[model samples]
Target: MRLYNRDWTRREIEERVGRIDQIGGIQRVRGAEGVEDGVELVRIRTGAGLSFDVIPSRGLDIGMSEFGGVPVGWLAPGGVAHPAYYDAQGEEWLRTAAGGLLMTCGLMNVGNPSEDGGISYGLHGRVHHLPARHVGVEGSWDGDEYEMAVKGTVDETSIFGDHLRLTREIRSRLGENVIRIRDKVENVGYTRAAHMLLYHFNFGFPLMDEHTKIDFPEATLSPREADMQVDGYDSWQSPEKGYDERVYYHRNIRSEDRASVRIRNDRFPAPSGAALPISVELSWDAATLPNLIQWKMPGQGTHVLGLEPANCVVEGRAAERERGTLVFLEPGESRHYELELKVNPGVTAP
Candidate 1:
């Protein structure tokens, strides 16, 4: 297995993005087309008996998100919007500029068409859709399932390359609910692009109800002190709400690997008719990647929770380092990041 890198030598990954034609002749329901969004979706059943709803959010060129469901969490749009929902306006700066205020951006629709409204900010990270050229696939397939790899790149002009190189490949195997997301990022320029932040990964779906429960081990969490609730509509905002009006910032975080965190998702509350979902895990075994974020926002209007696994924590990469949690890479240096979504279904009538 040759470890791929982030550099000009990388191939175009976009060529590989397409529908999965299963050998078993499994049928999938094509998602309704959104006239303006130009989003394409394919439901693929991996050899492992697990399935996934894969959508190529056409416009945002180079990027994609995978989970058992679509659009995972709250991504403030890129340009502008309600103050509570997004940080819309921002400026570019690394060592000098203040943290970019991310607001609503070119929002993508996922989940049921009629009610699709969640947003992913950092505009899904500028890399999400960077006019990818597309590379070829590597990896083999067994009788049950197979693996395919794709690559893409983009160039940003500056005195220094201040440009970025990114790579993400997915592994779909049999008998596993987990799909592995492998990524690499290289700062190909001179000045450090610190003062950075990545919030684009957000997951929401069957778990977007008040009955949903979010659980994690947090013995050393320091809550973001706020006397008032940020959201007024959420019935979940009352003081009785366990996690309302506050963001738990955890230190002394424990994980199977420091590169990533273990598990984060909204589980169905008991007394519901909905089926139980398997566990989803995002692990970062590489450098560059740090902090595993689990954000549950049951504010009045919107209902969803986000399990964000970022290369750097909130306030961006520099902020994490300022607080003594993130690592820095030199020019041309890179880090390998991987995420595993273990979808273990519970026993049911066959």
Candidate 2:
């Protein structure tokens, strides 16, 4: 069988079908008129049955993801909130959390509210609420494979406070159910600055039901709160009427250079009745992101499982500093973080 393109030149046609490969593509679109006004979105489709939306105005966060027409991520009912509506107080950030596949936390602070050295820091920091500057999206064919990416910069600064910059790139390849995120946080001020970052990957609904199970490397699991229940840390429960959220810290001792985790729902089938078992996998460098957090909330209308990898915990910057685990970047210094999310199909439990 042969394919012909009437719109392409001879050379272009040859390049198009040179390797029998599928090329992924990206498109820029305006937010829905009444749903997400004043927001810009980039819709990406990898020929491998993976698709997602990226909000360039919201720190380039992934707004939603799907595999074979089935949503793999959760979204807040409030939709995307503009930066002008962001509240730095506790719990107020949730009003505009978006709750997508990826919600980047931190550039200055993260976690619960706290007062450190007389400065009050709010919950989960302010990076996600900040708009990205110099946003650009592009797609290209790399050798026999096609790749697409969106790049941008987010600045978290003040007149006399910390001045940090985050340059982020979200990339995906054709015929691959994977999304890769690369970030570089630089201290642009004249003094050392405390930095915290967390990649909050949230899954919801059919992908995160009671039958869903989380698998991670052998690690020490510590409850965020002493009174928190630990009945089934690796498995989820049905959504309750008034269930309280639970947080656990996974301190993985990697036997290799990299650490990985997976959330699989073997009982969930593809929307097309295909034998594609649904699963999401996260892989990252253990040295860069030394901490992992599992946020389980099985509450009605708020069901989600967050697999967060971070440089610090969610105990606020003050607590992290007190524990000497708060990461700091010196003037003119920078740090890089790499994370990958892969969607697996046709995989069954052992």
Candidate 3:
């Protein structure tokens, strides 16, 4: 493992620290406050300055993240609310939607609030607030390399309804500044079920400033709202008061199996005294997540960017069915999705 400034053997690393945790490891903690009380979080530190919190009480989704003492994830004003506070009504999900590093949306629905057959669907979905079961965490050494992982299962099921089970695993290495999210959604019930999934990855503050650059995959882009299109649609702006959010959809991305987007900020200086930028890149299996959604909102106190990968668009479930883009899984069938996030402290700019 390469920690600090050079290579470290297992013996050398273990000898330096009385306990492995003295350098970096995983810890299970509970939120002890109003609304956030009883929330179980698995915090992992990669020793390489990458640390993040995974909420098992909230569908195994990731919360806050920081690298080199700098926060890269967006934390909403609502804090980390417990799953008990989730409301599935129209747009009510936003109330407890503690914006974090990654929020998993949907098992049955995604996007706009709509009703079908007298059943109402919420803003994003009910997955983010669903508690995970069979949670597991492990940090082991593979030869000289140290690998850490957290795994759990979250289900969005009800009586006579969809019985979708989502098994998620988040992995990272001791000296690596990268995290991978692996998920498999299965229809464990006896009936075929509709499935919609979207990974809402958010970035804010130091990572998303005025001069930040966003490099999206080459694709055909279209605005969600036709009239909201502007000249510099891909460029960001300074946070302005009362600014409206803009949504854009990217499709037909030109990539060989995997599609990615990079967000970079050059304001931070590196050890080499070069302004090479501190960047984060998200890449996923394009075959499963063929569409990308960009949520650009540079509003005062709400300055955050959400880059989402999904099988379905932001159109409601009903619209997805009407458009024939909704995915369905047969009984006992499963679908797998993989996504990786890499943080590069630009030793050499790309």
Better of 1 and 3 by TM-score: 3
Window of ten residues with lowest summed lDDT in model 3: 268-277
Give per-residue CA lDDT, model 3, range 124-240, as digits (tens).
889999999999999899999988899999989999887999999999999899999999999999988889999999999877777788889988899998898656665677889
TM-score of 1: 0.57
Alpha-carbon deviation at 346 in model 1, angstroms: 0.7
Q: How do all the candidates rank in terms of TM-score, highest first?
A: 3, 2, 1
Better of 2 and 3 by lDDT: 3
Highest lDDT against the true fold, candidate:
3
List lDDT for all candidates, in order.
Answer: 0.36, 0.83, 0.89
Candidate 1 has an lDDT of 0.36
Tell how far residue 245 is off in model 1, in angstroms: 6.3
- TM-score, one value per model: 0.57, 0.92, 0.96
Tens-place lDDT digits, model 2, residues 209-290? 8778888766788899999988788888788998889999988646467788888887775776654566788999888988
Residue 36 miss distance in model 3 (angstroms) = 1.0
What is the overall TM-score of model 2 with all chains considered together? 0.92
Pick by TM-score: 2 or 3, better one: 3
